[model samples]
Target: MRILLVDDHAIVRTGLRKLLAMVSNAEILEAKTGRESLAIAKAQPLDMIILDLNLPELGGLELLSRLRQFGPAPILVLSMHSEPIYVTRALEAGAQGYMSKNASPDELLTAIRQVSGGGRYIEQEIAQALILQSAVPAASLAQLAPRDLEILRHLAAGRSLSEIAEALGLGYKTIANNCSLIKTKLGVTKTADLLRLALEAGVS
Candidate 1:
């Protein structure tokens, strides 16, 4: 198996490399940034991709869409966020599997096997959460795209539009426009209300 590990943390990559060694005949490639991962994906064929959502410049959700244009390789998102919103956006972005960072090594291997074999997998706890969340009335958070969610998360963290633009490598005007769109979608007239909603939704 030819697998690419996309994560910015050296320790996490090292741990995953060691864990993936359990897969027979597995060859691993690593990238610490979204740009590097895109370059590697474009330059080679991969059997599977293990991606992390919290990349340096390019967010993982956006990267998932871009990577899908490269090949048929299945993507398994390994993220710290186990929220249903995160899982929903990832699946919508074309991920074959979603596993929280809290998953056991055994579960990680199972997720890798399933997704690489053209099957879908989600962490047990997260799957349950998704089910419960689905039972509730859909809200504006469900209407937000992955990028919009990222912006809301940053806003909940008390980041200004300028800071968010810098972090996302977008223009300030773009971020401001997105914030307005987010407000419209969420039915809020004020940024403070948006921040409150984001916090209530556990974005921070």
Candidate 2:
């Protein structure tokens, strides 16, 4: 199996390398930045990619998007951020599985194997969080894209569109478009109702 590990820390990569060695006849490659990971991913076909959400040079989600464009390969996220929002973002960004750093080594291997075998995996805690969010019938999380969810959170936190655009390093027009999409998806034509939905989703 050819597996590419994407993480910024030498120590984390070292640990992951040892754990992934459990794969039968595994050939592992390492990258310390999102850009580096994207370059390697484009260079060859990988059986799997284990990535961390946080990275330098390029954002991990953006890197995941770029890698997905190359074609299908299991991309498992190993990260410290285990919240539902983060998990949702990772899944929406094309991660095949999400494993929190707090998970047992056994779970780590299990998630890797499952995703490599063309299955999806999400941590139990994250699953429960999503389920809890689903208790509200209106403003379904499914309607929002990852980026939309992010903007929703910002809006719920009392950020203006200009502030959100500056905070996310995006154009004001882009942020406005995303906000409009969020409203359309959530079936809320009013900004106040959108904020209420965001709050209901526990974004605030």
Candidate 3:
């Protein structure tokens, strides 16, 4: 099987390559950012993709959505963020599996194999957390106003406040106010915390 490994870190790609060598007949392609990953995906026929959530040019969930727009491929997210929110968003964005970077090599091998075989995979802890969250029937995560949602999406895509304002045709002050409101509603004290909350809630 052919796999694409999308991560900014060379060491991470190398480690994954070494681990997968033991489990499957896999030829790996590497890309450092989401833009490069999309270009590579367009040019190659890959059986699966091991993606990192914290990409430089684009967030992993956004990349997953873009990839799905063209075709369906098993995307197994291998990320450092183990929060249930990140896993749920990855899955909702069309990822076939979600595993933490802290996972054992055997666990990653199992995830890759399962996802490549057209099955869904999630870490045991994350899976249990999702199940528990489902039982609570809490308010929707997209509770922000339309402007806040737009800002959240841009933030999730790794855009700065000024960039988001420019892209959305809004004034910098207006965008800042909206962001402040979003943080208040989400009960987050900082942009990074808001991002974490948005990812968990699967806002985009």
Candidate 4:
């Protein structure tokens, strides 16, 4: 199998190349930045791409969206962050699979194989963690409007009310009110509890 290993670290590429080679006769190509990755992918067809989200030049999500235009190769995101927001964003941005860097080597191979086979994979631990966070009543999360959910995600990331307001282009009072309502709907009395709930839900 042919695979592209996109990471900024030379040691990381070397380690991944060695591991991937052991799993299969993979012709692994490495890229240090998003531009190089795109160039190599456009030049020839790749069977899969294992990507790191914290790239140097280009943003990982933007690169992911652009890579979707190149071909049908599944993009497997290998990230250090197991936060809900990170996982959610990667999947939402078109990742075929998501695995935390802390995953076992065997799990890594399984995720790659599943993604290559046109199936989705999420690290078992991460999946279970997210599931447990979903212990809120049935449709409890479903009750949230998309905007409220988005706000919740920002909150879980430790963003201040003003920061979230600025980022969302809403007023401070508006965001404060929204947070109040979110806390009420979530049945949490404290800001910390709301944030904890959001994190449990894999918001970040």
The lDDT ranking, best first, is 1, 4, 2, 3
Q: After superposition, how far is residue 106 of candidate 3 from its true place, in Å?
A: 0.9
The residue pairs found clashing in candidate 1 are none
Clashes of 2: 0
- Model 2 quality (TM-score): 0.69
lDDT, candidate 4, 1-204, per-residue tens:
789999989998998998887878988899999889999999999999999876765656668878888999999999877865556667877899999889999999899999998999999887876666544532455556546766776787788998988766679999899988988898888999887766656565
Show how many residue pairs clash in every candidate, following the order shown. 0, 0, 1, 3
Give lDDT tens digits, candidate 1, residues 68-176: 9999999999999887777888898999999999999999999999999999999999999888874232365878877898888888888888999999999999999
Instruction: Name the candidate that leads on TM-score.
Output: 1
Total backbone collisions, model 1:
0
Error of 3 at 39 (Å): 0.2
Compared with the true structure, what per-residue lDDT tens digits does model 3 show for residues 60-179? 767788877655678999887765556666677789899988888878888888999999999887787677764221244435443455578679889888998786667899889988
Q: TM-score of the candidate numbered 1?
A: 0.92
The TM-score that candidate 3 achieves is: 0.73
Point out where model 2 deviates above 4 Å. 134-204
TM-score of 4: 0.67
Pairs of colliding residues, candidate 3: 85-200
Per-model TM against the reference = 0.92, 0.69, 0.73, 0.67
Compared with the true structure, all predictions reach lDDT values of 0.89, 0.80, 0.77, 0.81
